[model samples]
Target: MDTMKRLGGDAFAPQTTYLNSASTGLIPAAGVAAMHEGVQATAAGRPLDHFRDVEAARAAFARLAGVPARQVATGASVAVYAGLIAASLPDGAEVLLSEDDFSSLVNPFHSRPGLKVRTVALEDLADSVRPGTDLVAFSQVQSADGRIAAVDAVREAARAHGARTLVDASQSAGWLPLPQADFLVAVGFKWLMGPRGITYLVVPEDLGGLTPLLAGWVAGEQPWDSCYGPVAELAHSARRFDISPSLYSYAGAVAGFELLDHLGIAAVRAHDAALADRFRAGLAELGHTPVHAPGSAIVSVPGLGARQPQLSAAGIEVSDRAGNLRASFHLYNSSDDVDRLLHSLT
Candidate 1:
């Protein structure tokens, strides 16, 4: 499949190879069209319904997560859910997580007063938790090194230990089936191929009416009522967690979801796995060891800080983290991109 041309010609600039999907995905043409339609409608004083767009985005996100629509909520970012979850916990609560995970999931709790945040190796996530651990928070795929998380094992351990599980699926959801958790969040900008400023949160119905850390009118039963009188009741569904989303972002996210649905996620994952294997093999041939375990889509070549600039000069867009040259494979990447990267490295 010539995904580069099909997904969007505008998304893929000429002579540029984008291998940094882990950072920000190439926004699809569908997303761009959706955003434009929304902007134009509003400018014309005939605004498209914001509620309808957000609900569509939420449903699309739920489909990707393999969860029910009621289980999904739209938020500003993963930090919104992370902070709400953190604030829901009492001060001095013990949270078990990886030091390598993204800061959005960790820093919220760390910045809070009296919380004891304990760092564990990503490989030892399940083993690190024991009884009395209040929460287990981490990413399904580490953003730094792009290691696939053994989250099923962690979930099992968290269940046994009575610890609430929080998964940040920012790097994994569009690439793999999500692991069940008490709370799961994914940004639309990354693998979802949507605009930034949109995030989806999965909150199971069993969690019940959570007190919104940041309350708003939308979360209430009657947002349209001008009484300003009764609190009434918050939504029983994940709608309670929604503070609302950027209208344009929501529109783009809705379109992105539909595009992925048409492409089929299973095929997307297989393509990524193959690309990863090819890139790893190529990197090895270049005498550069891959930083992640076998078959990871995020390939890191450490201590090649200068090599990244040369690749950039050659029109390859990748990332450098902690002195490691990080190249992430997505559905858009082709074998040609891998060949280009490997040839540049040599």
Candidate 2:
């Protein structure tokens, strides 16, 4: 199926050429139906229907990550999993993070009583790892500049020092190849095109005896049976870290996962890259030189921050942050979107 033709691509309709998948994705028609079904089920007192969708969504994300279903857990948001990760680390351990990375990872460790937070340049992480560092955390892709981090190298360096790693994959998951890390968290709202409030937390099975940070009924060896027991043993899998998403959100994520599964993650990635390349080339031809970081699907138009309103006035949608007019690409975007953006600039 032509990706654009699939999922009722014309759903965007008479106006609004969406080019902001980095900020939020346009949910597909099937996804909307799934969400509606979930909502109706909940309304009819069948809220438990969410677990099946949640399980299916977890499996889909597992396939995307090239991991097993046992390593995937549903969460409410990135911050929730970040906090759990922070709490699981050994007390007084030092954590290294990039200076410009998102704060969700940092704020969690900052609140931990004895943990030490260290800042280093994103490019220097691989060189900065040391024996005493217990954890290293950073984004798989930088949200601001859309730079794909040297995360695998960072992971290797951390492992060489016997330290674990956490990768916030919020910007790269669903549409990009996932990095190998000790932990990863991705929100479903962006590239996955699911409803907001659904997040997937990935932790390998070999991570043993992690002290549960946000232990709940579902985080037990047996949720329904272990209720109110004396801090029951955490489940042997990553599901132990789950902060289960609501029924509606779970249904939406499942729908999004199904769409990605149907289209193939690699195909979506190639499409996004092609569109991003076109955007950069077109802007450059129009005298708008783009700042690019290798392997990222974001086109950075410098000095676009001030002209964002004008671009929007001309019916273009993108994020303007600081000095950058950041336009992200996905399967839904087309050549016309880039052309319109260039024409608006001219």
RMSD of candidates 1 onward, in order: 2.4, 2.5
lDDT of 1 by residue, 1-346 (tens): 6442223324444358889988998777677787898899999999988788888888888887778998887888888789888888877789998976798899898888888889988888899998779899999888878888888999999889888889999988777777888889989898888889988889867753356766566666566651366547776677777775688987777766776787787777778878888888887777888786665778777888557788888799999887888888887788888888888888
Per-residue alpha-carbon lDDT of model 2 for 1-346, expressed as tens digits?
Answer: 5433223354334358778888898887777877887777778987556678888888988988889999888888788878877877777889998887887766887788889899898899999999899899899887777888888789889989999899988889877988888888888899988888888888878754465667687777687765785646777788787774576777777767776777777788877887788777777687777766766787777787788877777778888865788888887777777778778778
Best by lDDT: 1
Q: What is each predicted model's overall lDDT from 0 to 1?
A: 0.80, 0.79
Prediction 2 TM-score vs. true: 0.91
> What ranges in model 1 sit over 4 Å off?
1-15, 226-231
Estimated TM-score for each candidate: 0.93, 0.91
Q: How many residue pairs in model 1 have overlapping backbones?
A: 0
